[model samples]
Structure formats: C-alpha cells, structure tokens
Target: RTLPCSGRNLLPSTCGENRRRVVRALATREPNLRPGIPDLNVLRSGIAAVLSVALAWALRSDSLLWASPVSVVPQQWITEQRTISGVVVSVSDGDTFRLQNVGPFHPTQDRHHEQSFPVRLAGVDAPEISHFGNPAQPFSEEAKEWMKQELLGKSVAVHILGRDQYGRIVGSVRYTSGLFSHDLATELLRRGFATIYRGRGASYDGDLSNLEATEINAKAQGVGIWSLPDEELPAEYKRRTRARAF
Candidate 1:
C-alpha cells in the first residue's frame, strides 16, 4: 500500500511533527508491509531526517542572525548587523583593530580588499595617530601599544553595528579569558585612553549611563588624555586637520 501523506505536501512548519508521526506509524506496521518488498516509508523518513538536519546546520552557520547579548549596534543597522569571532591580527590604534578568520563571508565586510576585517570600537573614540606624516596626538602611540598587548593573537567576539564613513566596521568587542570578561570600549574609557564619543552620527542601541560613568571617573583622576590641561578632543583634532587641508 502507498504510504499516505509523505509530509512533502504539508507546510514547512508542520512537516517535522508530521514526519515523526509517519515514521512511528511505519515502524509499528513494518511486519505488515510486503514480505519481500522494501518499505518505502522507512526510506522516505530517513531521507527526510537527513535533509532536515542539513537545513538546520546551514541556518545555524549563518553568522548574520546569531542571537547575542544586548549589543551597541543601533536599531537601524539590525538587518545588516551580526556577531563574528576571530583572532586579532593587528591593532591600528586604541579603538581599531583588524580581525582575521572571521568565518563565513558577510555583506558588511570592510572594503579593505583583504581577508581580515577592520573593526572600530563602538561608543568610544581614542586619540588619533598621525596619517600622511601629520602630527600625532598625545598618547597615540601608547594607545596603540596598549591595544596590541591586550588583543594581539587573542580571540574576540565582535558585535557588528555597521560600517563607518571610512568603511570600517563599527561594533563592540568583548574579550573573555578563563572566567572573566570585559568590553573593550569600557576598559579604554576606564583607563582614560579614550573618551565617550560625542561626535554626530555616533549612536548606541542600549543604555549610555555605564559608559558615561566610566568616563567621569577617569576624568576625575586626571589620567592619560584627561591629564592635559587643555586636551584637544579627537573630533576637534579631526576638524582642525580638515580645515588645514584647504
């Protein structure tokens, strides 16, 4: 007798349960099936089970929609946002690094034309390192060196927000070792190597109070960048550099 309802005709959401039921029904009536002929029901179920497992694995492999703890990526960037894990290949400055082996290609991959992706620490801005032989800001090299020591060769989880105007990925980075974990931006602010990003177009998705509190404490102690009686904000420095270009 033909196996009625192979579940291939049903809606996708209902297929799993229906398939399981069909498999159970077939198992119970196995002896009743033709003595010499093969049972088509068992073969069909086996195929279904394998296909279902493959589909599920493919979906899980998609890094673009993996669920994560509350991220700093703004709501507008959700569709293009995601999390990726990779080893830190290089540190550009206090707030930027290149991550390699991020696993699976993504639409928001930086335009750097390389395997490693560039990521900017979200919600904070570090001192600017000179480009094109321009003057470097105070503690710029220190910031870079500190980041290298902290992140170089270590694995990190990057919560991608979106691309910056420079085409670098803007996101939050979390570093976990043993039983302790810390957010990269928060630590930078706590040490005064960076400041709360007050620039326009820089927005975060969650509560801003914690970052603000960390900055306040760092400033109170007058450490790092805050130690300068009249420190030039990174934004101001960039603006000044632009004005001089003309």
Candidate 2:
C-alpha cells in the first residue's frame, strides 16, 4: 500500500509493523510542531512595529538638531543703544582703544560686567600707524598721540552702536568730566587725523552729514593728514601695502 506522506509503497509486508509505528509517531508530533513554527504574518507585523518606533525617534532627533543652530544665531544686525562708563586703558590708534571696568549697561551680560574690551570709534577711519616694519601713513603718529592725551586714564561715556568685522565694539566715546564734551570721532576728523568713512553701507545714524561737513572743513584748512600732498586714505594705504607684500 502507498503511504500518505510519500505517495508510494517503498516497504514490503514484512516491515508493515515498523511502518504502522512510524506513522503513529508522526501523527502524534504534527500538532505540536505546527504550533512551534513561526507564522510569516506575525513576523512581518513585529518588524514593522520596531521600524515605526525607530523612525519616529530619528525624526525627533533631527528636528532638535536643526533648531539648535537657529536659536544661537548671532544678533549682529540688531542695533542696540547702550551707554557705558569706563576708563580708557589704552589707545590702539585714533579710532581704536581699550576700555576697562565697563559695566552697568543694558542687556547685562557677564562678559561686559568688569572686563576690558577693544572699542572701534564709529563713523571714522584713522590713518595707519607705522608698525611691524610698515611705513606710517601721514598723521598716524599724531592721530595716536592725540587720542592718548585726550582719553588715556580718562573716564568716558561710550555710546555703544554696533560691531565691526574685526569683532570690536563700535561706539561713539565722549569725555565725561572734561571742560567740554568731546566726541572722539568728531575731534579726530576736526584735526584731520582721521577721515569720515563715506563708503557704501556706512551707518552713522544721522551723523554722517555733520561728519562730512567737518571733514570738508579740515580738507579746506589743510590740517593734519590733509596737509600732505595727495594723501592716501587709510583703507587704500593698507590695501596697497598688503599687495606689495605678495
């Protein structure tokens, strides 16, 4: 007779008892084996569940990473008006100086509380000083010395305007206890030690007209740097000197 599993009679009648015993064993185990085997539909459902959870977590992490940089973007464009009182520690040039004990200003940050910061005088560009074997532009020494006398060790009120590309705070400084309130940039321009920066994107906040007038008067009187024949602007002088180095 043919066996139900193999569809062919491979055993003779002498082995009939052995075949009957083997058939009975398989029949008894078949029910347990079917339950022990994994179902394809159940396996696919479990994998899908795990992938969905991982995808959700990844999207949340990506959103947080994208938001971090946007939150910390520097506020360079937002102009804030702040008045700070500090003593001039050093003068870098006519247009730049170091101020100490700067504090009590608006938007109080720990860094500005009692530290020294380099300040670049806004709305003016001073002549280039002779340093590092570079030739001094006209009136550079005079400009520096003038600022030294007027501001060194002197307490002044600084009108914080913005920041320059070199990361220096740009402001208008005036002596607080002098006989006459002296705006440092105007003073420099009046003496012809510096020039009004009239380049594109120059922001003096309505003081450009006044600064230009002062510069014109200085030029007419032939004072300081204006007295030199065909004096080069400080910016142009720096560029030409740097080019020569190459």
- Scored by TM-score, the top model is 1
lDDT of 2 at 221: 100
Count of residue pairs whose backbone atoms collide, per candidate: 0, 0
**Please, what is the TM-score per model?**
0.66, 0.61
Model 1 over residues 8-90: C-alpha lDDT tens digits?
A: 55533445676677667767873667677878888999999998996677546646332222233334444567676766778
Model 1: which residue pairs collide? none
Q: Model 2, 145: alpha-carbon shift in Å?
A: 0.6
Q: Locate the minimum summed-lDDT window of 10 residues in model 2.
A: 62-71
Task: Report every candidate's CA lDDT.
Answer: 0.75, 0.72
Candidate 1 off by > 4 Å: 1-80, 103-113
Per-residue lDDT tens digits for candidate 2, residues 1-246, read 556444365543455688788767767864344757887777899999998997577434421111121122124322545555666778898789987643234222332313567888888999998886898887898999989998887677767677778777777777844468877788899999999876544567568888899999999999998998898999898778889888
**Residue 163 local lDDT, model 1:** 82
